[model samples]
Target: MITTHPFNDDKLREECGVFGVAGAIDAAAMVALGLHALQHRGQEAAGISSFDGTTFHDHKALGLVAGNFDSEEIMRLLKGEWAIGHVRYATTGETALRNVQPLYAELASGGFAIAHNGNISNAVKLRHDLVRSGSIFQSTSDTETIIHLVATSRYRTLLDKFIDALKQVEGAYSLICLTEMGMIACRDPLGIRPLVMGRIGPEDGGTVIFASETVALDIVGAEFVRSVEPGELVVVSGGEIRSHRPFQQKASRPCIFEHVYFSRPDSIVDGSSVYTVRKAIGGQLAIESPVDVDLVIPVPDSGTPAAIGYAQQSGLPFELGIIRSHYVGRTFIQPGDGVRHLGVKLKHNANRPLVTGKKLVLIDDSIVRGTTSLKIVQMMRDAGAAEVHMRIASPPTMHSCFYGVNTPERSKLLAAQKSIEEMRQFIQADSLAFVSINGLYRALGEASREEEAPRYCDACFTGDYPTPLTDLSEREQPNQLMLLAERVGG
Candidate 1:
């Protein structure tokens, strides 16, 4: 079985991505391209569901989109003009075929298939209640909770039922669902997750597309439309589009980390270029914590843009001191602990000639558990670097994220457990610094994080969650939730 390389596993992971297209011929193929563009968000599994008026067809598998959806035979079977797809990393469910999404269900109204891109924080509690009321679940995915909620709602129309289901749950979600009526796209009220809309040319059947990121729309050659507004439900049917705001209006709190690491640098979120925001973040870091070093070096791909910003701001030459191997397959296997420990070079290696005598400033997006940072610093020292100072582009991640990010428990987060100096010691670096919380807000165009109603969700850094964590709150102890989650999954 393919697994994430150890060198790449010590980071917070976005749970999944969703893509949907309506009114296009050969729509499944377009969905495939969109999902492929979104592959970076989630890499464990992928699935697609399509509707061709009278019938619904789907194919789900435990692998990358290219591996599972590139076959002509599979595409031929997913016959429909309305399609939605998902790539998953298993935030709430087991890594099994049944847990793969674009989860399909045959409801009383018709066939319903949904692709979800965030966690339903109250899923376990809702699931327990649903089971006691005789709702038999087919998979452990929290997404299915929405389906069951819709199925049991007494609302008159499918749209009403869908809205009814959403109102009953809490936490971040950006969803794309396909049904007999047409296609529906919506984001939770807080907008902690992202969803955007786009339109294909008339030549391409004038398709309306929705995806977790603008990058996916770009992949399908779809023109950029506005984002699906928070607390708004958009429906495309009868060759016309309709928008609904079924819930009370509230200020949006989109995820701030999207600019730091989760999103592709090429994508745009909340009308700002992610690449530009990251560069600004790096500049903020340079201003807040100036360092005396010979060269500024980025950890690798994710850190490159920020490093450039830091270089421009601090007037230091940015160098690629660490070269990442592009050909290193995600499925690369290490047979044992000894082999795994030696596998760091399989992904990145220091440029010995460039770093032999230089005092370097290393820039990275964030330090999670600090294992990757520690190893990278050690590797640089082994290459004869005179000094290494680490600068983080974002505020220290001191809290766990429950809004669909796959973060370790708070206890395991390096920043949560250690002070900046302590983290420097743990990573064996000469120095370390992170952008202050207010500095992060400044980078994002806000003067400061408004404590009463912050503009974005920075919960992972501040522990200021916007929604009630029903499942976690119900647990009497920290570990009790893990036990309860296992039981709820059953």
Candidate 2:
């Protein structure tokens, strides 16, 4: 039977990707291309919603963008000059098609569709109150909570209604919405998630594109204008665009792991090139934990930049000791349980000749559950490596991410449960060291993580969450909120 690859479960999974284009000819086509570029952020499902003057069209499917949105039939069905798309990994909802987004609704105002990235920590509590007040929900996605809020809001204007909905929610969100008026895009006040605005032509008649990352804009030949400011909303209509800041501005705390793992290497987040920052992180890791090794080797694609930085800083040769198979798309048919046990090698395998008896420094982004790390160390030893010292580019991930990342519970986190030496023993590495939190801050060009107000969100490493976790606090009230969460896929 075909099953999704389980080897990638050891790392944090990004929640979703949002892409939209306004005032563009064949906007749906541009949105499809942009969604393809942001596919790494989400892979389980893809959807597109478009508005053509008087009518709105939508198409959603369970699979990759290439599998769903690449078809001429699907593209032709989504006919419009304004479009928004979403790729989802389902952090707050089930994997069923009913939960797939750019979720659309017919309201008193008109047809409204939304594509959302990030999570709402207070969704469960809000959902309970909404349900009690006669809000019938069709999907379990937290994004649907916003729609219900808009529908029941006392605000007069659609724009005011959107801002009203956002004010009631607590947590990270970057949203792209399609309304009869035009397209609206915004990031949460904390900027815990990412969104950027770009344009394809001259200011007057150009297509305005919004995406979760700059790489999405690049794919559609759009010139990046700027990141959507935290607490700011941008609206496009009739070939015109405007910005509004509805919430009070606070220090932005964009997710730091975006540079380490979530974003594509070519993308830029919060004015920093993801690839450049990753390399700097590797340099920091090397300085913090220098090792006597024959060569520096990256775990695979995600680790390559850091590995290069490590080699450059430590004055060692960088080698591709492990090769990853690009053919392993998302899922493969596994014959039986026994073969499943060896699935790790299907995606990655060591280059036997290069590391045959040589001591190596293995570079990786971070160790999550430690299962992948254990398998990789074992793979190196089996390939005749004399020694394997593992170096992590980021600090130990000791806390679960409650914003947008799909993380295991705190108990499952390797670093949260074990010390550095214990993790070294568990992974069977000769030595294991992670970049210090201060080192990570330095790599990002900060003096250090300020106790008063950090420039970036390092909650995964420091256990200092920027926002309140409402759902967790309501965990004891199973009959009221927690029970509702199970039914709503929170």
TM-score of each: 0.95, 0.96
- Model 2 C-alpha RMSD to native: 4.4
The residue-by-residue lDDT of candidate 2 on 279-332, one tens digit each, is 999999889899999999999989999999999999999999999999887777
Count of backbone clashes for each model?
0, 0
lDDT for model 1: 0.90
| Per-model CA lDDT versus the true structure | 0.90, 0.91
* List of clashing residue pairs for candidate 2: none
Clashing pairs in 1: none
Q: Lowest summed-lDDT stretch of 10 residues in model 2? A: 474-483
| Native-referenced Cα lDDT, model 2 | 0.91
lDDT (10s digit) by residue, model 1, range 107-154: 777788999999999999999999999999999999999999999999
Candidate 2: TM-score? Answer: 0.96
